[model samples]
Target: MPSSFCYKVLVCFLLTYSVQYMGFGRVELNAQEGYIFENPYQKTEKQTDVTSFTIYFNQKSSQIPKSDEVRLQSVADFLNQNRNYEIYIEAHAVDGKNYKEDILISEKRSLEVERFLLIHFVEEGQIRRLFYGNSKSPNRTKAHAALNRRVEIRLQQKN
Candidate 1:
């Protein structure tokens, strides 16, 4: 009885904090799926995941794509409007080099994106960098390397 009660209390705490701190529009707890946080920033359309953006990079290149200029601008605008949210700049690269080289490449890309965000007036404190070169690739196959070489801008609520 005590163990079950403790678990219930813990689950409640998680649900509350997940919604409160993460700005989750809705939070659901289930034994099979665990905690699911719905997108809070979405206004008109319902999304399966959290509100975020992704920017892809060219092979061995860190320059922000011209086509993604609008997307980055939108991110900057959102951050400027919502001060309570911070962005996780997740960098990924294809596995074309040794482990260290892969990481370095990803780091360079992450830095470039950071600079872009900073120049756009997003608070320095609001940007966090996470570089995972090939290690976290969704697909490592040659054909999918292009998909791995990318940056994902994800939002997390300020604590």
Candidate 2:
């Protein structure tokens, strides 16, 4: 009887491990420490849990740069499938506008991202955090500033 009980326990453990390996979990969208926008578009033949994708932006560019259209589409697609997932749009900007005071460009960048998502019909409440006015990292350069100006999306874990 003891040996039979041990066999049952071993079987249960193996089954649980198999389920976990088979992508039987929810995907979590997470933001990296600094670069928030990770690969917003990842194609998976089999469904697996992805934490989330991050979308980076530019601070100096007065308008949305030309490169983001495709990524935006990816985000839209993801939301369509995962409507229950919550999002956080973090906006950031360079500290100085004209070598003087802070212009709060980060706020503008974040808002723009929100607007884009809104245009696609992602409801406002699904977005939990509309963080703004994040300072530009000192390591960023003028040419690379746009990379810093972005809104990131992260999934809120369920309670």
Residue-level lDDT of model 1, residues 65-146, one tens digit each, is 7656656777788889999999999999884567788898899999999999899999999999999877898997899888
Encode model 2's per-residue lDDT on 87-155: one tens digit a residue. 676655565555233345655666676777789887776765554443545346777665555656566
| lDDT score, candidate 2, position 61 | 45
Would you estimate the TM-scores of all the predictions? 0.66, 0.51
Off by over 4 Å in 2: 1-59, 98-103, 132-147, 157-159
Best by lDDT: 1
| Number of colliding residue pairs in each model | 0, 15
What is the C-alpha local distance difference test score of candidate 1?
0.81
What lDDT would each prediction earn against the true structure?
0.81, 0.58
